[model samples]
Every structure is written in C-alpha cells, then in structure tokens.
Target: MRIAMIAAMAKNRVIGRDNKMPWHLPEDLRHFKAMTLSKPIVMGRKTFESIGRPLPGRHNIVISRNSQLSIEGVTCVTTFDEAMTMAGDCDELVVIGGGQLYQQLLPKADVLYLTLIDLDVDGDTVFPEWDDGSWQLQNSVTATNDKGLQYSFNTLFKKC
Candidate 1:
C-alpha cells in the first residue's frame, strides 16, 4: 500500500493546541474530508480522541499502546505495523495524525497533503520538520477562510 500523510499546520509547524487544532479553517476541514473519504485512515490515540468520533465514510484505524481500548466502529491497533497490515489491501493508506504519529511515520509516507496556515500561533503539538529536498511539490491552491485566515492546500510527493 502507498502511505500518505495529511495535516494542517501553521507556518511554524504548530498543528494543535490543548489537544485540538489551533485555528478554525472550515475549508481545510472540507478538503481533508474530501481527500480522505472512503480511505483507511490511521491515527494515534490522542488524535482520535481529539476528533471525538469516527469520521464517516472512512475506515478508522487508531494506533495506541493501549491494547484493551476499543471504540464502536473503529479498529484499534498497538503499532503502526499492525495498522499497515490491516490496510495493506488499500491502494492508498492515509495517516491523519497527532505530533508523535507524524514524527514516527512521516519518513514512511510517499505523499503529503499539507495545509499550510499562513499565521503562526502558540501550540502544544507540532508537526515534524521534513526536508524540502525530499519532497517534490505536486499541487497547491491558496484560499482565505471566513475569518480572514489565509492557507494553502499543498500536495507533495516524496522523492523516490
């Protein structure tokens, strides 16, 4: 399966604050939903809780060390390998993550769908720093949010 990552972060790489996204960008949210619809999405426990429920029209595979954890309509796994094994039949495996998961699996991903928010904000969670030389930009589209926040949805393919 081809692994891909999807995240929204500030220019400073802040993905979240207090267990939630720092900014409200509805357009980016819609973009995420559209891109991930019907795909198998892997995420860490914190990320799942932050979302509070399984996202409709997708397979939710959550990675957590907690083996006894179970959620209705969700599959919980103990390792990334487990998640990958379960999703192996899928043509594309999408990782929608919290900081730790992104840091651990970014190197394994073949594509990145990133929403680069224009403003910097204080946050407790951060997306990992990746080398620009390792990813080739495939597409980008910029748009402004209802609250005047500007952001770009960028798709980058990892260099082979």
Candidate 2:
C-alpha cells in the first residue's frame, strides 16, 4: 500500500496551531478532497476531533493513546501499528494530521501532497523538515485563492 502525507504549510512551515489550521484556503481544501478521495485516512485523535466528524466517502482511522476513547462512524486505534493493520491492503493510505502525527509518519511516507502557502503565519505547530535530495518533484501548480493567498499544489515522490 502507498503511504502519503497531505498538508498545507505556511512560509514558516506552520501547519497548525491550537489543534487547528492557522489559515483557510478554499482551493487547498478542494485539492485535499480530490487527492484523498476513496483512500483510507489515518490521523491522530486530536486531528480527528478537530475535524469533528467522519469525512464522507472515505474510511477514517484515528490513533489515540486514550484507551477509553471511542467514536461512532470511525475506527479508533491506540497505536500506529494498529492503524497500519486496519489500513490493510489499500491502494493508498493518507496521513492527514496535526503535527505529532506528521512527525511520527514522515519517514514512512512514500509520497507527499503539499499545499505550499506564501504567507508566514504564527502557529504553535510546525511541519518537520525533510531532506529535499531524497525526493523528486512529480507535479506542481501555483494558484491564488480568492483571498489573494498564493499557494502551490505540489506532489513529490520519494526516491527508491
């Protein structure tokens, strides 16, 4: 199964703050839906809670350390291994995250779908840095949202 990490980060690599995204870009939302449709998404419990519900048309797998935690309409796991086992033989599994999930899964990702935002925004959470030399850019397109925020939708493939 292919493992992909999808996120939008600001110029300063801020992906989130206080359990939420620091900025909203409609175009980026569209891009996220398109890329993740039909795939099983694995995220931390906080990430799942932040979204508030199961995303339609896809399976949601959440990892949390809380043993008593359970939510209807989604499978909840206590560890990453359980999440992987639940993911099974899917064509692709996307890690849609809050910072902690990204940090844990970065090394295992086979591809990255990133929305590179142009502005530097304040946030408590940041995306982890990676070595650029190990990945090859597969596709990229820059577009400006109605809010006039310039961003690029980029897909990068991890080198074998």
Best by TM-score: 1
TM accuracy, model 2: 0.96
| Candidate 1, superposed: residue stretches over 4 Å from native | none
Which run of 10 residues does model 2 get worst, by summed lDDT?
Answer: 79-88
Off by over 4 Å in 2: none
Model 1 lDDT tens row, 75-150: 9999999998887688999999989999999999999999999999999999999999999999999998778888
Q: Would you list the C-alpha lDDT of every candidate in the order shown? A: 0.93, 0.91
Listed in order, each prediction's TM-score against the native is 0.97, 0.96
